[model samples]
Target chain A: MSEKGIHIEEHRDDEASKLGMWLFIFTELLLFGGLFLVYSIYRWQYPVNFHEASLELSVTIGVINTIVLLFSSMTIAMALTAIQKNNKKLALRLIAVTLLMALIFLINKYFEWGHKFEHGLYPGSDLMALLERGHLLYFSLYFFMTGLHALHIIVGMILLIIAYFKVKKDSVNSDRFVFLENGALYWHLVDLIWIFLFPLMYLIT
Target chain B: MDHNKTHITEYKVLAKILLLLIFCTFLTISITSFNLAAFTVTIALLIAGVKGFLVLSYFMHLKYESLLLRILVGSIFLLFIIIVLITFIDYSFR
Candidate 1:
């Protein structure tokens, strides 16, 4: 049953890829772990200050970004599904859409941050004067955490763009949907990170 | 093994579920803006958790995967979250 053996090996490779991604995701969590520790210490020491600072953030922006990320997640899924079904054209289109949406997300974040910076609300700037003591700490954490998360989104977009072109050139076929699958997994991780950040940054009472 | 039929059905269902999640997100935002701070955050996170579950189970194909693999991944994710919370709590408490 040499053929059966080969089949098993193929399956194992897929599992290995998934396992590798999972490990990377775990590392990502730890990366954010350090930030979470910093936030809690600051927040604990000055709860009232942080609460007041939190109000400066625009919930509308956070909500819109959440929607953008969620929509990107959907597009990535559709891309993978397209590849699985051997619809290369569809896959390419979906990946392109995802990349575009990611670009829009970055644009939105830039404007939001720019507004704050213009108002002298930047870190180590006049943030203390523009908002309450608690709020400054909260905004600082928001900027740092969300800035890091935004970087991840940028990286994910680059990966997806590369995958899109590869799929466009028929470089990745239905028999080899691993690229799209992994790309989607990365996007989902980005989405997961935002899901947590949204509440921590914008929803604390 | 009608691959075409199965693929179509899966894609359709996934799309519908994602749309519903998007709607839920909008609803959460709308409800929270009314000054219900405690309920808003909790409900928003609860909805987000639900949405994440759907992505993992349906879109990511975790449901069709092996139980061992599922447990392995789930435990790792949960462990990471625990580590984060614990460190945060330690700092906050200190």
Candidate 2:
């Protein structure tokens, strides 16, 4: 047999990459899961205080944010569908809409958190110090959980922005659009967390 | 491998799912107004679970994924529930 040059191949398995993303998502779920466990324990111990503190949250703002996130999730999912169909323009527009919704969500969160700060509900504030242990824990978990969620929103937004430009550049297109799919999955996970957070924080009072 | 066979969900189906999610959100809020006492939290969490499922299945496209991925997600949730239950056992005793 004739001597042959060594051949090296680079593999790009979309399914395997998606599986990796799903695993990362599971770790995220457990991360928040631990926080939720703490919240549940505290809520169990101080139901009345938790109820009172939860009532301080604005149902209107929570509802608006929920709707906004749900709509954004829809838009991102639709964006993936658009890209898969080779409709790059539509995909970009959809992702832009999703990003806009994320901004709106953050703005609402800013106002909501600001209103709470105005009342000194944050942890370690004199007002908070005066509150009972349950109220203290409630506000503490509220800030922690929602703050972490907001941070994820910022991260997901950045991911989508990168995906947006990639789609525009044709790097993420019909033949190879795993980037958009993975980005959309992360965005939906954010929405999924909020789906639980909204009811747990605002409605159960 | 035919890696190009992407599943493209219909726009109408996505719209319908969105509408259903909105309806569920409204339902959760309306039920909260009734002050169902002990059931309030349970009901809220149940609705949220349903909403989460919709987002996972449709929005995240978990429904379209392979069995291995489904099992992996399911196992993670199962483990979370176990940990939560075990913690509750400790708290309930105290």
Clashing pairs in 1: A49-A134, A49-A135, A50-A134, A53-A135
TM-score for every candidate vs. truth? 0.83, 0.95
* Candidate closest to the true structure, highest DockQ: 2
- Model 1 spans with C-alpha error above 4 angstroms: A1-12, A126-133, B1-9, B30-42, B84-94
All candidates: DockQ? 0.39, 0.84
- lDDT per model vs. reference: 0.76, 0.91
Model 2 / residue A33 / CA error / Å: 0.5
lDDT of 2 by residue, B1-94 (tens): 6667767898888999999999999999998888778898899988998998888889888788788888889898899989999999987888
Residues A49-119 of candidate 2 have per-residue lDDT tens digits of: 88888989999999999999999999999998898888989999999999999999999999999998997
Q: Which one wins on lDDT?
A: 2
